[model samples]
Target: MISTSPRATSVAGEPDAMSAREVLDLARSQQAAEDAAAARKLEAAARWADLHPPQSRHHAASFTLDGIEHEEAIAGDGCPTVAEFCIAELGTVLGISTTAAKRLIGHALELRHRLPRLWAAVHAGCVPAWRARLVAEATIHATPALTPASVAWIDAQVTPFAAKVGPAQLDRLVAEAIARQHPAEPVDPDDPHPACPDGRHVTIDADQVGFGGTTSVAAQLDLADALDLDHALQTGAAELKALGSTESLGARRAMALGHLARRQLALDLASATRLAADTDLAGQPTSLPAARALEFHLHFSAGLAGGLEIDHLGRMDEGQRLMVLDLVKSWCGDSHTKITVKPVIDLNTELTAPGYQPTGRQREQIALRDRTCVFPWCSQPARRCDLDHTVPFDHHAACDDPAQPGATTTSNLGALCRRHHRLKTHGRWQVSQPASGVFRWTSPHGHTYRRDSTGTTRVDSDPDPPAPPNRSSRAA
Candidate 1:
């Protein structure tokens, strides 16, 4: 049974209580509700936008002089320019941030003025509101704005497939629209268009930083350029081998790329002689004047069977971890990289500090314990999250009686992202930390969720309701 305690939100019943058909129907109903909720949220934001039109007499609303231009371009022509500060007010009510609220308002305005067909479809319930919003968001925030005609075309193309279209498909459609919307130039009907295409490009996979603390690099270069690069890398690798380097060809090639980036590659035999002189018999540099000190936060593992986690570089197994570390050492020796071994924090111990702020060590302890924000569905890193007191901190009592020491302990505190922290503070969401790193969250809609290190799960009211698996069995 789910708790009816003050902290727990009262939920209806369990999903396991229902038959397969009933469960299927429940899924359909919930999807409908979700669609309606997204619609209402957009409409609410639109209403707020309408209410807060840019006042003629209003003074500078921007925080800085540099932000004025951006503030002016917040909305398009015919879309009501919303008052700047009002966005934050709406965000507080919606349990989102000002930036999110701004985006929502912009999308709504884009739908209303720029993409009317999509707007009509959204209100008619012909399309899911979020799908329509995604189209609007793409148009509203494109690198260079799409024309009204282009937006209309996009709306027409996407309206039919809105029910099942994915982001990639939508992005392609949007890109096509943007490409068709050309720059200002008088049309020359007789202009010759060549079919020539040069798709040469270099791309570093910045989005997916690898688990072994390395970035994947790909390049499509001109034939001559590729050959020259290959030759330089080969020469560098040969020179390193001549200087008694023991790294594999691929590894040395990667190191050569780094050397190229730093312009430390030996171009000729004379340069190679100078490079050799700089290196000692151990194949290590005597002194690296421009060597950079790097910091790597490695979480120690008791056994090789378990993976080791390095901050920014997910988790890696023993062999992979060792290989990556060796690469790191090659880049900068032990003397160049600072690896401080601090005492392991006692996770079970409830650490505390005075006043509202946690100590640096205490913060680190919480970051290690939670790993992410304790809010349901939020995976923001704890290092970037606010450590919130589950219960409201009573400043008078806390300061007056040192004996009580209420909410400052690890048992009472948990990591909450800024958005969720505001939600708990300003919005009606309630949270409780029953143990260190374990958070129980109650939504404004009366849904209860438990969030721990493993992730969030719903707290159902009933585990085994008095019902059989099938209606036929129950009838029998």
Candidate 2:
């Protein structure tokens, strides 16, 4: 039986009876049209605002959802870890791209951390819903790695300056301070030619300083030359003089000096000219490398030999001399050295070592094998993807398959970006090396897929349309 209720009426019908099913369908269609119109109106309004200059006319039509305030449970109580879990699930199980999932989780986590104040600013009619997000980022959740304490600190710091300057400026200051306080440790080729056959080393010297830290390459190298190598002894029976009586020379400086000495003695050596030149902060060219390549420090480690206790350049051992000679050879491959600038490191710790001890053949092979990134969706060329161990040597020895040996074997390596490397290590993803050059990806949800060297589809023969969303189906 069909009802003649006004709710079921399509219009002021001049008396035409309709079934309940037809009436409901007509009502739904009308509601959908209304929604579409509203959406269009909102979009048009936004576009109009973009073109026209905002004045009194912009606020001519304003409305609010004024009633009573409502309460909701605060976030951060229920699994702030939820976003990370979701990212892992989406990346691993759903077969969604890890990059897309990572971005989604990043935004969700950011919102969760500061939804309270963000929502309040919007409710007061002071800002738009979109503006709330901008405010959230500018005020509440400024950085991706903001802790509760950091947020509180930021709020306290910004309240005093919000009127004079702006939150963006404050963000820059905070970022700078954070960087100054905790800079990254340089890691790469300590001795790119560990087995150079010829006993040659490159000695780098200079001073390095950050916000409040300094490394004296010259002073530290002096300490290493004063140690007993055969018995790992510091033969200072006399006053047992400490490396540095001055407050300036810290443990880091000592370590720098020690490492520098060792670098000099190694069969291969080179200054991190490329790395130094790349990070050129304006106004402070000396901090990186625009002036001298690296400032030679007096102190540094001497590999197996003890630390250089004092400045003694002439007393360098046969190994150290060989290292210096090689540096000269590398610098002046033809005849006279063309390099005008000497290396300098005011702070020893600031020095960076050269990259891996790659044989020319090994490099050539790597270039050929990895033409580009190996990640499924990543189209980044070979230049971008870093060569990484397919089966990380860090994983337990028991886990490594005995069938595959050699560290330099092509079968043991693949290319991945820095982000994907983090995903594999920290996130819930697994890469299987069942066969040589055949990479299989199983989503967290157990959906298996494969990609070959050509980065082309290697799907089994299946002549059919795309399968519905279910495990028992195959992708078209």
Candidate 3:
């Protein structure tokens, strides 16, 4: 009898008992099979596109499911009929976003029409699907304008190295192919380096702010200006290290950048400090006189005062926290700063009242607790978000009665960016807050996800309990 157990077969050295090399080969074969299967699925999606051609630049379709009618409109000169249909149908079938589905369809069309050689390699499982998609994307811009002969030539050049090259190397190869095909096209200049630009031109943008009080900054500058900024940051970081600062070099550099900007702007630190000191805890202007009318509040946890480690909503590390404290000290100068302790309100408690709007303190507390937009995978910081009520406020209107209004409390409120807020209000996406700061997000496709301070966790995975809030070493 053929032994079913691997150990028993291995001891007898049965023909089916493979060596390590043979097992590895079998695994590789299985992986290739899976890749080929995925390629076939993509091809099938592409074929569906061909079969269902859009009748007009603008089209409307309606379907009924479970006695409910659903209608969708597709309008835009640039949107192909095949693309619209595939994105809608395939997105539902695959349990993915329409954006993702559109990308898959785009890759499929690019492979089938633009790069036949790459498609062949993908279909044969010689090239992984991701790499195939990358090649298709890289070549797409050039392929549109090029002649069939030129596209074929570029395809031949790139196909042989598709499986062998990494993303960066493949990008280089694609650039070379484009250059060879379009010899007259102007090449982009190299990115800003340490050398200063000849002219003064600087543009700064805050690309994104995440849950942890972390901000991503994007900048474009003249070469000389870039170099000068880099040098200043390095110098300041070095100076900080010399002055008994234990922060990492990266943390010091970030602090240096902030300091350099402040110095350049000639911030009136003393005037600002005086204004802040005169302001009440509620941020109301006090009767005390101030050097300047403008005041700034540095919102931070009291734990940092006692030198305790706290990750700012997963945004800052110990080094960053230390640098922030040091920056605050520099701002304070020689003045004696008073630290006040306040009673901590239980977030889980319902603090709602008659009105729909939450109090300023409630807003601040909610923003601090839920660091980002409560939408799953959304990293927009709470400060930049809209405070949305999970349940519609009852205003004795047609839709709701005043007797049972949704309370304007922390448990009923969650932060959502304007776009997502509209989505929740209008789109089929349903959201509920079973507890304070914890949100359950249900997508249009019926997938449910839980979101909180840390990030998103799918409900199907038996997610762990929400992590306890990291408390400050010193009681507030």
Which one wins on TM-score? 3
What's the true lDDT of residue 94 in model 3? 62
TM-score of each: 0.55, 0.30, 0.57
Better of 2 and 3 by lDDT: 3
Q: Candidate 3 lDDT (Cα, whole model)?
A: 0.64
Model 3, position 364, has a per-residue lDDT of 67
Q: Where does model 3 exceed 4 Å of error?
A: 1-20, 30-117, 139-156, 180-220, 226-258, 264-345, 353-359, 394-401, 404-407, 441-445, 450-476
Which scores better on lDDT, 1 or 3? Answer: 1
lDDT of 2 by residue, 261-332 (tens): 443311122343424444445733242122213222112233334854422222111111212333333434
Where in model 2 is the C-alpha error above 4 Å?
1-100, 116-360, 367-372, 378-386, 391-407, 422-428, 433-438, 451-476
Candidate 3 lDDT by residue in tens digits, 409-475: 7788999887567667756677788667888876666777778877777774554445446433221
Q: In candidate 2, where is summed lDDT lowest over 10 consecutive residues?
A: 467-476
True-structure lDDT of candidate 1 = 0.66
In model 3, the worst 10-residue window by lDDT is: 67-76
Q: Could you tell me how far off, in angstroms, the CA of residue 12 lies in candidate 1 after the best superposition?
A: 29
RMSD score of candidate 1 (Å): 13.0
